[model samples]
Target: MRILHIIHSIDPRSGGPSHALRGLVQEQVRRGHQVSILTTNAQSAEPWMPDDQFRERMNNDPAFSGAELFIARGYGRTRPVARFTWTPQAYRWLRRRLADLDARPDIVHIHGVFSHLTTFAPRLARRFGVPYIMRPAGTFAPRCMALGRTAMKRWFTTLFVAKDLRLAAAVQATTPAEKDELREQFGLNNVVVIPHGVAGVKDAQTDAPAARRALNIPERAKVLLYLSRLTPKKRPDWVIQAASKLLSEYPDLFTIFAGPDAGAESQLAAAIASSGLNGQVKRFGFVTGDQKRQLFEAADVLVLPSQSENFGVVVVEAMAHRLPVVVTPGVASHIYVDASGCGLTVEDSVDALTDGIKKILQADKTELGQRGREYVRQHLTWIVVSEKISEVYAAIIRNQRTRRRNRSVNQQIRLTTK
Candidate 1:
């Protein structure tokens, strides 16, 4: 069967969404399925988007040669970008290319609903009589709108998102929390919960001492690793104040905030200084591959402490590496950890985060990390996620075929009666 996946951009720093897409496309190709991707992020003769626009490069990109890549982009800054995603020029460009759509596709799986690729492509899928799947990721969260920095999205959704969401053959959710959110937001009941999986790195976990040595962390220093972006909605200030309170108690403990600094790095520095927690806080900016794995391995505990998170892919990634996690209240997996005893979840406040961190520091790392990795191995992984997604695609394709056949029969019957 022919399958097409659509996304607006391939920026790796965009994080899990692009990674998940790459993994899915690769697995489908491995399974001998015809898969292609339509992205507004294509490189024309001289690259489509400006060199500065793409903050990160997508490595081992499955969208490269095998997939039929079509480029698309929204003009202007990312904040007010959703309007540009569905601009008349982009819409016309897409319609023209889709006129010669490669295989007419059995299904189109859309990632990031607000992007140019999804905004216009879904309408095309609908017009071409194909099923389209919507994966909003965490964009449906209210705080997403707050962070989207867009008053335009509110109006855009009323016009496009609402209709596109309903017309979608099914909405793909990464967790039950997201499915519920979708149902509440758009009255969209046709939602499927299919959480993402991380392909874990073997021997990723490093002993605290060795990790500290590698990172130049002083001997006897305890590390609390925050392995994600420095973004406003993540509330890194909570982590800072929390670490400040725990500082005296855990004499050796130091906070390592790592990840690409989109905007919050200086704010974090200022917060740490104003809170009188200087020197105790260290910012590594962004570290991936070996550094990322070693940092997680070396930490005493993994702190997410997000105000609003969809699934917290980092939480599960930490689990896969057998690191105990302390997530903030709004993360979707907080309840899972709370129920399963995998780790702790608390409100996004300095006091609560501090307490949770201390609790994790005291917990049995061997047992807890072992349990966490076991649970992740049993439940999460790309193979399982891909299988579930495959099922969704198959069901959609089958339904479409059945509908076409039924319509044909009815047309024949009407003609006979005439």
Candidate 2:
């Protein structure tokens, strides 16, 4: 299958959608499918690069090997417009590709909403008689819609996104709760639920002692890891508050805050200082590759106290690393954690999170971690997720063919009658 993906940004620092797209595309390519990506050169706060350099970097990057990448220079560097991803070059490139019979995609997968790619890509695909699927990637979650330029989002949806969504062959939701939100909020009935998958599960389990030594962490200290973008919505402060409460009880307890500062770094730093737990808590900004693996290996439990998450990919990553997780109800993966009995799902409160952390610290961590690993091995691996996504693509293509046949038949009958 020739698959095309359109996303605003594929930079790892941008967050979950980027990481998810990388995993999905890599798996699809590994399965011998032709995959292509259209994206802008938006790498968080970094200065935008020219298209040629961006393409060269992406093509050479081992993470995206075996896939064709198209990069366009994008504009805007501030809030509201930062994610707009206005790329006329990408728009023109997609238009030309759709117009070319040889280059036309069998299916186009558009990721995220409220962006130039998501808004315009679907329209182009439809114009060329190609089917496309929309994956909102939690953009339509109630909490998300309520936060960050709510009025503008509502306006954009009504004027452009709603029609784009309605015309999509299908809209993907990473969790059932996100599906429910799509149905309830937008009245979209074509939503399909597919969870994000983790890659490299077998190699995820690293040597804990070695990792601890590398990070200069005490071998016997109880570690709680908060690994996600330090955005306000992620509520890193809540984790800090919860950690403070548990530190005295578990003197050996250590908390590690990892990931890029999205907006809440100062607040989190202040919280840590005020709580007087700065000695017990450490902030390691934006870890990736081996450093990320080490953090996972050295941690006892992963904690994500987000205000909302359609799917916490980090939660699954922690699971893949044989690390038990403590997530709040706002995290959609809480259902899986609860169902799999791999971790604890606590209410979205500091007290509840503190107690949940304490419980995990007091409980059999090795057993809990093992259950998480087993769950990932069985259900959350990219090998399994890609298969399900392929099925969805095939089903949509088949339905499109049937619709075309019916249209052809109806035209023939009208011509005969005339």
Candidate 3:
């Protein structure tokens, strides 16, 4: 099947949605499906100035090798305006593809909401009679809706997004909670639940000693890792406070904070200083590729106390590395953790988070990690997820063809009767 994905940006720093899209696209291409991506050249570091090197690397990245990529020049530097990502070139490119019989996509996959790409891509797909699936990626969740320019988002949804979502061939939700949010917000029944997938980890345990040495962490130390964007919603400060409580019990405990600072570094720093965990907690801002893998290898457990997470990809990634997780109920993947018996799901409070971390520290971590790895292998790998997504795409396309055929048949009968 020919699939086209439309997203605002492909930059890794743009967070989970971009990374999730990359994983899905790569797997789809490997399965022999033709895939193409249309996105703006918008980087989180400098939105107005497009990074030529980043685009070059992405084009050459092995993960995206079999897919066609189109990156249009984007406008707007500020957060609010930047999201609207004025990319006239993307509009033109999509228009041409939809008009060409050979170049037109079998289906279009639109990611995220409240972005220029999401706002306009579905409209074009509908205009060209192409079935399009909308993946909200948790934008409609109550917690997400409360963040950043709520009024503007409200207006945008009412003016444009509502129609686009309602007209989509299907709206994908990564978890049942997200599915509920979509249904509640839109009063639509076309929601489909499909979780994000993670790549398998190889020799993560064998590499732990070397990973610890490289990071200057003692082999005997018990490491707790916070590996997501340091945003306020993610609540990295909660991790710091929780760690402070465990120091007396676990004297050799160390905490590692990974990922880029997204407006929460100051709070995290203050928490570290106040708790006097300056020596115990280390911040490795924005790790990726090998560095990220090493962090997973070195850590005994992973914690993500986000106020709301549509799907915590890093949690599954940690599980793939045989690292147990402690996440809040707000995390959509907490259900998987609970069901798989891989980790604990606690309330969104410092005391609860502290107790949850303590339980993991007190239990057989190795066994817990093994459970997580097995669960991910069985149910959350890219191979499993991509197949489910492919099925959805195929079903939507088949239904669309049936509808068109019926319309054509009815039109012919009317003409013959006349």
Candidate 4:
């Protein structure tokens, strides 16, 4: 089957959705499907790279080389969040590219909403009589919609996104909580709950002492990692506040913020400095490859205090590394954590998060980590997730075939009667 993924950006720092897309694409390719991605070079402000440099890196990057990548120009860019455009050039590029495809894709999967990709790409797929699925990727969650520029988001959704949601073959929610949010709050049917997959665990054990030494973390320190963008919604400041509260109780605790800052660096820096927790709270910007692995190995626990997350893929990543997780209730994966008894779910508040961290720290760390690892192994690996998604694609195609057959039979009956 030929699968085309339409997304705003593929930059890893773009967070869970981008990482999920990369894993899905690679796994699908391995499973004998033709996969292609159409995306923009849109990136956030911090850790800035010139457009040409970024594009060159992407093109030459081995991970991206597995699938054909189409990078379109986005308009009206700003720091941290670049608005996707409906420029004439973009439309022309998409149309020409679709025309050039040797075979129309069996399915066009649009991976987030409120962008031109969500509003326009599905229509383009429709023009070629292809089915498309829209995965809002938690963008439409009730709390998620309440964040920055609410009025504009409402306008965009009403004017452009709602129609697409109604038109899509299915709207994917990564968890049952999200499914309920979409159905009850947004009145969306055809909602499918398929959680994102994690890359298989490469090696669960890292040389703990060596990793700690390399990262400059003291041997006696207990590491708590927050490994996502420093965006407002992610509530990195909450983690900082929580760390401040635990300073007296866990003096050796080191809370490292390790990800690209998506317009929240200054705020986080101030919070860390003023709270008198500078020595305890460290920021390591963005990490990948081996550096990322070492951090995971060195950490005793992973924390994601998001105000709203459709599916916290980082939680899965942490669990795969056999690191216990502490996540907020807003995270959809909190259900798995709760059910599997592998992590703690706290309210999205400083006190609640602080308490959760303390509880995990005092518990048997080895047992908790092992439980989380077992849960991920059972349910969150790429092969298992890709198979489920492939089933959905197959079902949609089969339904389309049946509809065409029924129409053909009706036409034949009319001709015979005439």
**Residues 1-418, model 3: lDDT tens digits:** 8999999888887788888998999899989999999998877643323378878977887768899999888887677788888888899999999999998999999998877777889988999999999998999889898998899989999999889889999999999988888898889899999999987545535479999999888899889999998899999999999999998898888999998878898999889889976598888977888889889999988999999899999999988888889999889999889988988999879999999999998889789888888888989999999999999999999999999999999999999999
TM-score for each of the candidates: 0.89, 0.96, 0.97, 0.95
Best candidate, lDDT: 3
Better structure of 2 and 4 per TM-score = 2
After superposing candidate 1, which stretches have Cα over 4 Å from the reference? 42-68, 82-102, 147-151, 200-208, 275-278
As a whole number from 0 to 100, the lDDT of residue 76 in candidate 1 is 49
Backbone clash numbers for all candidates listed: 5, 0, 1, 0
* lDDT: the better of candidates 2 and 3: 3
Model 3: pairs clashing at backbone N, Cα or C within 3 Å:
259-286
- Candidate 2 C-alpha lDDT tens digits along 1-418: 9999999988777888988998998899999999999998877744455657766767787767899898877887677787796889999999999999987888999999888877889998988999999998888878888988899989999999989888899999999888998888778889999999999578434699999999988899999999999899999999888877887887888889999888888899889889867588877977888999999999999999999998999999988888889999889898879877878999878999999989998889789988888888889899999999999999999998899999999999999999
Error of 4 at 167 (Å): 1.6
Q: Candidate 1: lDDT over CA atoms?
A: 0.75
- Residue 288's lDDT within candidate 4 is 88
RMSD of each: 3.6, 1.7, 1.4, 1.9
For model 2, the superposed segments whose C-alpha errors exceed 4 Å read 46-56, 203-205
Task: Sort by lDDT, best first.
Answer: 3, 2, 4, 1
Best by TM-score: 3
Compose the digit string of candidate 1's lDDT tens values, residues 241-344.
88878878876678888877666878887888886655766778557677887788778788987878887778888888888889987888776576657789
- Stretches off by above 4 angstroms in model 4 are 79-81, 87-90, 97-101
